[model samples]
Target: MKSHYSDAPKAQPILRHTLSVLVDNEPGVLARVVGLFSGRGYNIESLTVSETEHEQHVSRITIVTAGTDQVIEQIRHQLERLVPVHRVTDLTVQGESIERELALVKVAGKGEARVEALRLASAFGARTLDATVTSFVFELTGSSEEIERFLRLMGEVGLVEVSRTGIAAMARGAETI
Candidate 1:
């Protein structure tokens, strides 16, 4: 006989989600957080951590991942149970949150290519963080999509390398979590 669950339809495609977690900034906290992801076989696309309130000894951990609605909920629930995690906010469900990432892109080229890189960077409002005879490093901050677009354009010009500070998000209004 067929299994009872065999007729169930497959779940929907996984959508990108951003989660902000407040935790104690004590040592080994980040490792524990990261370990939870790895141990559970979850994939983290973007991760950033910073001390939010020094006086309160709280740090914010922002993580971006792709998962179905149910999976996202499960992740959030699990995070909430972590000892060091003070709070977990799924910005995707919380509504109207501001999300941004910072990237430093290095492009190495000469002559017209160099000029083109500069022009493109200017168009994207990227600041020149460093410049050398044949290379330039641009610092940019924007939404993930905007960063992807900038990287694509830079690839055409001569992208050498990139370092990114992953998504940091917060709710728009008076909501604090």
Candidate 2:
């Protein structure tokens, strides 16, 4: 008899994943879904839910979380077992997915900061949602990384407030979830 304990495999790196869940548009469904994550000690980075199919009474919940491959698979399986969940698609694992988030940024500045802010906003393709003498509210829709960079630059200029819509993702091509 021999022991091979020293040959254990390396631990998998934690990776970010986006899960799109199709669920019934009814009460407590969202709560249950969230509870599952909380109870299992899973951390949700971003979450967005809305009734996508009004006539069908169905909603789409997009959740971004970080976990190992095994943990992500387990979460997906558990979600599928829930009564109200119709489907759980891991957009990260799915090939060629599109992920986007919208953010509203407000900056108040009097001098050069204002000019720089406007220039950066133009470069980032952020539209001027509202503008006043002292402040401007810019609307930006892009990947989370892009939004973060925009916010960081704005912070250096004259960032006042920010409101963000969590990540909304879908598989590219003709697939529907």
Candidate 3:
């Protein structure tokens, strides 16, 4: 006998989404926004916030998270209900968008290892920000996946430390949010 629900489709797949939130650049606003995620047990993969309109005291926050469609919609609705929130846009689903992240990587090596590191960094278009006999600092900017690949390769050479500025995303066309 066929089960009644056997032909139903599988559960929705979880997907990574980038959200752009415009809000008032007032103290505690960021805290409140972050609190919502924490309170709900949602995970934030990357978060970047900066004041975009100094005169208007408006800020833009770019948040990257992963969840099912329903969960993402719930988060968006909740954010839209916030007092200071001016706009909330899901860049990932809204249309074409560009996302970039910057990372400062420090590698310590010598001899062949140092040479290989320099070569790999050059091939990856990473700039040599600082260099010493024992170590070097490289700066790289690209998509999250690109940065991850660069870091993984660097680890094989001599990655010592890294500092990443979370993703900054914007829509491609004239549509503003």
Candidate 4:
């Protein structure tokens, strides 16, 4: 006999979601929002929050997560129900948006290796922030994929460390979130 669960519908594909939340810029507001995710056992891949309107005392939180469509919808609903949250926009589904991340990549090498690193950095449009005979610190900003690719190349050479400034996303149109 067939197993009972075999007849169940297929699972939805896991997809990347970028959620933008507008909230009151108040103490403990961020903690409460993050608690909701941790309490629910959801994973947050990237989070960037900052006050966008100083006079209005409103902040924008951008979170990148991976989940199915249903789970994403649930997250949006829960965020809306929070007292401090004024709006929740799923930039992934809303419309075209600009998403970018900044990274400070440190590579240590000398001679030919250092030369190659500098060449590659120039090719990728990375700017050299600090440099010495042995190590170089480069600042790069671009899509996540581009940053990853650049890091991989640096690794092949002599990647020492990397500091990434999570993701910052905003809708492209004139509409405010």
Highest lDDT, which number?
3
Task: Kindly list the per-residue Cα lDDT of model 1 for residues 42-67, writing each as its tens digit.
Answer: 99999999999999999999999989
The alpha-carbon lDDT assigned to residue 174 of candidate 4 equals: 82
How do the residues 40-84 of candidate 4 rate in per-residue lDDT, one tens digit apiece? 989999999999999999999999999999999999999999999
- What's each prediction's clash count? 0, 0, 0, 0
Provide the clash count, candidate 1. 0
C-alpha lDDT values of all predictions: 0.93, 0.96, 0.97, 0.96
What is the C-alpha lDDT profile of model 3 across 58-139, one tens digit per residue?
9999999999999999999999999999999999999889999999999999999999999999999999999999999999
Q: What is the TM-score of each candidate against the true structure?
A: 0.92, 0.96, 0.97, 0.95
Off by over 4 Å in 1: 1-7
TM-score computed on alpha carbons, candidate 2: 0.96
Cα distance off (Å), candidate 1, residue 108: 1.3
Compose the digit string of candidate 2's lDDT tens values, residues 1-177.
666876889899999999999999999999999999999999999999999999999999999999999999999999999999999999888887999999999999978988999999999999999999999999999999999999999999999999999999999898575
Residue 37, model 4: lDDT of 95
Clashing pairs in 3: none
In model 2, the Cα lDDT at residue 49 comes to: 100
Ranking according to TM-score, highest score first? 3, 2, 4, 1
Alpha carbon lDDT at 119, candidate 4: 99
